[model samples]
Target chain A: MPFVSIRLAGTATKDQKSAIVADVTQSLVTRLGKNPAAVQIVIEEVSPENYGAGGQLLADRDAPKPQEDAHAESSQ
Target chain B: MPFVSIRLAGTATKDQKSAIVADVTQSLVTRLGKNPAAVQIVIEEVSPENYGAGGQLLADRDAPKPQEDAHAESSQ
Candidate 1:
């Protein structure tokens, strides 16, 4: 049996969660030959303030304008 | 940064959760030298019916009398 835990930065719609569960279950079944009924998936939505990466809180990182991706691509 | 996700079979009290967070944070800080401020811990309490081990649901397994542990010990 495999228990999968997914942590997201924010809340997800019911439909989105359902899709994720289905996709994760299918992947485990296909790759590991695990029983679909035995697969468990728990999705945890944490506030941005509680989630951090690279020593910066997600809330602070997201607060800035969404220009970093474009700036990086342009520089490349 | 270390993100710790704990999956429990059922709900935990706020105090219990706080203790767990503190313990986990301390462990990471001591062992990995991670910053306490950068550590994120999410506790996911899932229903027994959703968790399975050895192809049996935790709900069903827990429904039986808790004598199995004693029986195994006695046998040993």
Candidate 2:
């Protein structure tokens, strides 16, 4: 069974999660022979304000969104 | 965004899957204050052949053990 579960928002590097469980258990033990202790890799890490993208967060995705019609035509 | 990925062997009832999405999403929204749509629940179903536990396939999980001193001999 290919049990590769990697949920990420932060915190990787225990050699980048053992190189993603040794490159997905050596690609399922060299193209599906399997049985490297049945290959179970689970990594779940989170906390960039609980994670988001495009819709923002990750510290407001590098800030700078104050257009507001160029400050309302420079305060009229 | 709590994306709950469910990879199970064979198919589950469609209602079953949507239930998983709803349950986890609602749990996130209700408890953790998350956006419902941002909770991506990915379902990846596999065939019995590609899945194994206790060094055996799903087809084999239900069948009788030939006195191999069963570890978790029931979960169908």
Candidate 3:
């Protein structure tokens, strides 16, 4: 049995999740010759506040959007 | 930065999840010398229906409680 777990920021839609499950299962089946029925996939959605990348919280990094700031300044 | 993702059957409580995150972080800190703040842990809970082990669905395995059935038979 092969179990695959995916963790990402909580922004994926239901369709995206389905696709991930299918793709991961397919990879295991094709590469490792695992039975499709025995392949399990779980996707965990983490809030930006709970996710840290490169020693910085995703929430903090997402708060200051440089592109948005530039756009606001140009529109002013 | 170390990211750890755990996938398990969906039976764990909030306290269990907290302990898992703390322990995983501590392990990374002790073994890999990674910054505690930079260690990210994500726990994904999968329903028995979606979890497969030994080529059988967990839901199916859980349905037949052999011990419980034996006890029921003994009481009859």
Candidate 4:
């Protein structure tokens, strides 16, 4: 059984979820000759606060800065 | 570095999530001798409607049914 788990940075519409499941199933069927019905896919939407990169939480990294000048100074 | 993704059929409390992350990280460290700090675990709580098995959506399978007799009749 091919169990595919997909993690998205944010939420997705029901349509998007449906399309992903279908697309993934099709890929497995086409490439691996797997049974579409047997393919299980799970889509996970992660909150920015819970996911981190570059040693910074995404929520913090994407948050608005105080001022353009201050931000530029901090980056330097 | 190990990235672990866990998909649960339903939601979990924040405390439970924290424990799960810690437990998973510890497991990797103990078994594979990976650094606990380098272990990344994402816990996904999936809606029953979005998960399917045995050719039926979990939502439908877990939904409240009609009278007991009617349900028994349909299963046969």
TM-scores of the candidates in the order shown = 0.48, 0.50, 0.49, 0.53
Encode model 1's per-residue lDDT on A1-76: one tens digit a residue. Answer: 6877778898776556666777787888889999887787666678999999989999998786568887998899
How well does candidate 1 match the true structure in TM-score terms?
0.48
What is the C-alpha lDDT profile of model 3 across A3-36, one tens digit per residue? 7777788679999999989888888889989999
For model 4, what TM-score does chain A reach? 0.83
What lDDT score goes with residue B73 in model 4?
A: 92
Candidate 2 displacement at residue A27 in angstroms: 32
* Location of the lowest summed lDDT over 10 successive residues in candidate 1 chain B: B48-57
Error of 3 at B48 (Å): 0.5
* Native interface contacts kept by each candidate, as a fraction: 0.11, 0.00, 0.18, 0.07
Report the alpha-carbon TM-score of model 2 versus the true structure.
0.50
Models sorted by TM-score, best on top: 4, 2, 3, 1
The C-alpha lDDT values of all candidates are: 0.78, 0.63, 0.75, 0.78
When 2 and 4 are scored with TM-score, the better candidate is: 4
Alpha-carbon runs more than 4 Å astray in model 4? A67-76, B1-45, B49-76
| Two-way DockQ contest, 2 vs 3, winner | 3
Candidate 2 local lDDT, B1-76, one digit each (tens): 4445555556666766665556545544554456777667676778887777777887778666765456546532
Total clashing pairs for each candidate = 0, 0, 0, 0
DockQ of the candidate models in sequence = 0.09, 0.03, 0.12, 0.13
